[model samples]
Target chain A: MTMKKRNLLLSIIAVIVLFGVANFVQLEMDAYIRRIVNLCMIYAIIGLSMNITNGFVGQFALGQAGFMAVGAYVVGIFTVPVAMRPGVFYATPMNPAIINIYMPLGVALIVGGLLAALIAFVIGTPVLRLRGDYLAIATLGFSEIIRIVITNASSITNGALGIKNIPPLNDVRIIFLATLITFILITLLINSSYGRAFKAIREDEIAAEAMGIDLFYHKNLAFMISAFFAGIGGGLYGALLGTVDPKNFLFTLTYNFLLIIVLGGMGSITGSMLGAVIVTAGLEYLRVFDEPLELFGMAIPLFRPGFRMVMFSVLLMFCVLFWRKGIMGTEEFTWDKFVNFCKHPLAYFTKKGAHAE
Target chain B: MEFFQAFANMTAASFAQHMANGISLGSLYAMIAIGYTMVYGILLMINFAHGDIVMMACYFAFFGITVFHIPWFMTFIGTIIATALLGVVIERAAYRPLRDAPKNSVLISAIGASFLLENLANYLFSGRPMRFPDIPLLSQNIAVGGGVQIQAICFVIPVITIISLVVLLHIVNHTKTGMAMRAVSKDYEIARVMGINIDNVISITFAIGSAMAAIGAIMWGIRYPGITPMLGVMPGLKCFVAAVVGGIGNIKGAVLGGFILGLGEILIVAFFPQLSGYRDAFAFIVLILILYYKPTGLLGETTTEKV
Candidate 1:
């Protein structure tokens, strides 16, 4: 009868249909397709974590991979069998100390999240004291240090050999379910009062501080929460691959995450989900870039050789130059927004689906 | 033989070696540092894409020599001019639009441009490490005294650095454009209201900064003898730290900071063998210390903001 009710009903129906179709695809899809889906979910978790710091709390953090390294190593240590882990970070001899700390999958993920969050708390304490680009540089420094520590602390991280036999997470169904749950929970939390406070801080820190929001504490909270999610993502990644290496968490890891946040629109939760999916798929779609691209019967190497990243940069430049607000801006999905979006899906499609409408 | 002995007795060979390496490396860093300082002085924005721009210049050189058949003599003007143009274009496209936006947006955009450029390089180039061609001009060694041999390449570096500084100094102090730049940096609104063309000034600043980076990039390729998509990340970051150390907005401070950091980095490595693994850490430690002790840097005067 009402627009809100109608929109809610449509959303429910749409989600149910999506889930039903996803389940069907999971049952029938090829291994490659399933792997792509898993990667998308993993990246989405990372994007969500990054969004907390960059999008919500407005801090420039470029060292996410460093935190992910903490998550990956911690989770790998717990998830991998004792004998295999020693093979990776062999310098850090298994003291017979942590040999028996194998955790159940869920607990391992949470442990990974909690450990990363704790690390963030320590890092953010002094670093976030500075504002703007200085914070980015500090966080980036933290990530690099984490990487070096892992490399040098071979006894702990096995240096470059990394952790292996982490147990294969072949079930796409589990990933889909986990991703859905995390997405829903985050979406709900972002709609809550706490999320509003986060947004207020993002909009104007001075204004937010004037309103009595403790800047340091809230920033720390946002950072830890982001790291928590990132850690979980890393844990899940370790489980999925059944092996982990320090190199996997290079500075590049954070760059891609930055791209996801910027392209999706800073401070938009739904945009994060959409960005993760699109970017994940886009990485695959770019395989065409590796092939000598056939353009109107002319094999254009421009589209073929390293052209994917060129196009990606072109897209990035286009976004910055033209669409500075990104695809979503700071706008969020609402009941009225949903109705308005659904009313003209074509126009919505033309402009990034109306930023969560 | 007596003189050699006397020279050795007077100065520890190791000490001389460390000092030489420090000064050489510091001078190299000083060159890169100028790019970072110049941009920050005008825009109050750290050009994160700068390192990638330097890296891009190296790739361009690599392509010119290896792929496109360009002569080595022409590479200097070729790469610098091209990169300088790219710097201008980047500022126009990525940075100029967000002139009035919150500082964070431009910061993020610069990072995005960094990723975009790196990935672009990775895609086009092999993204793997490539061996730099040996230029006869750079590889020659001249023994100055005793067994102390100076690479012909080393002298060219400092000479080039001095020349670059002179050019930049002239531009910043003498040009009408430089005056407009100083005006903009002091107060953006006042500059805008004073009928200065804000975008043009910013673009020129970016172009000058980029041209300097191009020279630094070419020198890095020649001296370092290896190239990768990631080559710029470390130097870009280190030079940026150097810029901050020198008092970001001060040109003279950048050169001073670069030399200090460059020398400091090498000396730390030389004295403490264990710290070699943490060579990168030294910069951050210095940055943090500098930030704590004198947030404004060596040549910078501290300012109380009008909140």
Candidate 2:
């Protein structure tokens, strides 16, 4: 069989297996473990969206949280039952226009993504003109502006009290399917001619422009698509948590996505997937550092709350300093490479070293 | 007419008080912006950790005074020294290794350094705000006639800011070390070939920048009377906006930008109290507008990109 055919078959089988496992886990596992798995998928979507802009396009935009906030609030507002709207908007009456409109979960998620894309399109017009650090800071500014706006628009966002009783999509299967679709769509885009244009721009904008690639169009396209997925992920997050607040979408939340991309390997979709799982699971595993411990019957004063995040940040610094290229670098998990690695793991290391030297 | 009426309703004393508050806040921003501009000038990269270094300075002084029972003068000296050392160490460890890396990688490293410092501070300080040790002379409220009450530090801050700016200007324009710094900033390769110790100059630049941050922290603590691990985040971002508004890489521009931001923030609240909730958004709006219309910023010279 051809390699493409084999890969196609493998992907199909993988999906089936994932669906089966999700079904079993949903039935067997406790709520906590199931929640973690769902979060891993949600984070995977977020990481992929970030990778599209930061990794593939080579734009250092740091406005993921802002876009996510747009998505979360949009989904939260539309999907919250109409009866609960008054209680959610207790600071003031629910904006009467939106009060009567109730959207299904799927439609709300899409509208959330589209709204985020709309905002990105508006901001990207002026912002994509900037290069390097200027672009980074500009995008960051927009994100902060979004949060501040959300805080003040109490009639809509409920003024920082946040909305509770969001209809929870607690099913693991739903998250798994959503993540799979997002991954496939992004992968296809990255492999298309437009994706090549993005890569060309990333490599050298002037040269790409000389080659007749429209820099503004391609950059904005990638940015909007990224925002769309980020919105979807944000909507899922709101649904998963059963709550949404402006505070939940703070600028610092963007750092989590940054760390994922940096660790998973920029420009590699598989790497982002791997990164999301490891980071999400690793964060949970590191909960021990935040908990007080007793060793030899003596309480450990140093191992207290807040220590986990400290260790996590140090790990991030070490990763940046040492493993700047990240786990997969730019390489994807092709079947051929996987087969070669399985045959001889040492050979992979030696080959990488040779290439470096 | 309504706007005029509202403006007229305010007494002269309240206006003066607002101006004093603006100047005080502006001077603090100016102090921090100097560090940002100098680092950007020399390195051509945002020193993301600069704000955290300021936070660390506050904590250092806090411990020195409260735990060690040291005098305020000694605490100030120690904070400056320690902060300077930290700046030097950060440059050596985090930045030096990535000197030859892509600009984005270096930026990510700088961000990582910032996160590490903030989280470390959070862990060590327990994520709580600490009462800044009161310096009686500086923290006291003084009546400056016409019923205008202002913190004594407000009077002291601008004086210190001006002196620092003058000294910094003289050093950069006149002194040998300053000349070396200017040359390095102009072209590191040419400076190196000219037998200048590039690393040493960079270290000195960081030390000076961090010392300014420490001084800013002291003034910030005096004015605000509270310090927290996250205190530096907002100021850091605003000062960076100031640095950009003043035309990044220009020291004088940073000062001007700082004053504009400080006064702009205060006046916005005074004139449009209803929109006061949008205060934090003001700096960002200014940033976007400036970048769109005049990317070079006020007083900044434009440079052509070379192929």
Candidate 3:
């Protein structure tokens, strides 16, 4: 069979398997396990969105949390049952206009995404002009500003009491499908001319500008797209947690997505997907370290509540220090590469070793 | 008429009190901003961990006084030294390896170092906020001219900030080490080629910056009386903003930026009581405005990127 045809068949089979597993988890798994799966997919979507700016466009914008908050708030406001509005907004009444508004989960998610995109457009106009750390800091400031505004705007955000009873969204199928669509859309975009323009800008802004790439336009485009998906991811996150508060979108929350992108190759789609699974699952697995453990009736002093976070930080440092390129290092998981890797796993390591040397 | 009446009731004494408060706060910010400016002046990296160093220094001071029963003066001295050592150690571990890496990688490493410090502090000290050990001499409220009362440390803070700034200026301008820092900042490769020990200079810069952070932390702890692992994040960010606003890499500019920010914050709240909830957002709004109007910062020199 031709390589193209074989890859298509493989992709079809993979999708079928993904749905089958998602169905199994939805039907058989407990809420706890189902939530984790949903979280992984949501993270993957968020991670991919972040990659559009940070990885592909080479803009070190750290405002994902802000965009996510926008998306989450949008979803929370629109999707909450009209009956629950009074209860949720007990601290201060929600905006009179939005109080009675209710939309289906899918529509709410899209609206959330679009509103996030609009905010991104407004933010990107001024912020994208900054370079390097300045851009990072400015975006971070905007995120904080957004949070502060949300906190102070009591009537709108319910004044940090946070909108609760977001219709529970633990369905694995929907989130998985969202993740898949996001991955595909991003993959297609990244292969297009605009993606090349972004990569060129990333490689050398001066050269890209010289090549007639409208730096501002492309940067804004990449940023808005990233924010749009981040908003959707945030919406899913709100639904999954059944709560949407300003606290959930702290600047520190952006670090989780940062960790995922850095763990997976920064620019690699599949790596982000893999990273989402590993990081989400790994964090859950790492909870054992946080819990008290008595080995042979000798209580270990090291096992404590905060140790897991310390260890996580250590892992982040280790990754940046030793594995700078990450697992994928800008390389996508093509079928050819996978087949090659399967055929000669040892050879791959040796080649990598040689490169290191 | 009500709005006009409220404005009319503001006595000159109260304004003076606010000014005093603003200057003290500005001086604290200036002191911390120096750490950010010096590091940026030398390494061209943000040292995201600088604020965390202040938190660590506060914790060190807390432990030295409370746990070890050391005197406040000695604890401050010891905390400064230990924090300087910690700064140097952080640079060696997290930044040194990434010296030749891309800017983004270095930034990631710096952020990683910051997170590590925060999490480590959390693990060791727990997430509970600790009361900063009260130094009676500094914490006591003193009545100044016209019955305007302020903490004794408020007066001491600006004095210390000015003295340090003068000393730092002397070190940077009139000393050999400062010359080397300038050269390194200008061109890292050329500085190295000219027989400057780049690593040692960078370490010294980190040490001095961290020491300053310790001083600021001590003053901050005394004034605020609360210390937590997350304490550094906001101040660190604000100081960095101050440094940027003053045109990062310019020491005096940092001071100017700090004062402006400090006074601006105080005056805003004094003038607009209803806007106090948006106080944290004020610095950011200033940042965005400054970035838009004068991207090089208030005192920063404008330079075009070379092809």
User: Ten-residue segment with the worst summed lDDT in candidate 3 chain A?
Assistant: A93-102
Q: How do all models score by TM-score?
A: 0.89, 0.98, 0.98
Q: Candidate 2's chain A scores what TM-score?
A: 0.97
Give residue B284's lDDT in candidate 3 (0 to 100). 81
Task: Provide the lowest-lDDT 10-residue window in model 1 chain A.
Answer: A82-91
The docking category that best describes candidate 2 is medium
| lDDT (CA) per prediction | 0.80, 0.91, 0.91
Give model 1's TM-score versus the native structure.
0.89
**Candidate 1 local lDDT, B58-147, one digit each (tens):** 888878888787898697789999999999988877888887778877887787788888887787676789977678878677776657
- The C-alpha stretches of model 1 lying farther than 4 A from their native spots are A1-22, A86-96, A294-298, A339-357, B1-11, B62-74, B144-148
Please state the error at residue B91 of candidate 1 in Å: 2.1
Q: Summing lDDT over every window of 10 consecutive residues in candidate 2 chain A, give the lowest-scoring window.
A: A331-340
Q: A38 in model 1: Cα distance from truth in Å?
A: 1.3
Q: Which stretches of candidate 2 lie over 4 Å from their true place?
A: A342-350, A353-357
For the candidates in turn, chain A alone yields TM-scores of: 0.88, 0.97, 0.97
Best by DockQ: 3
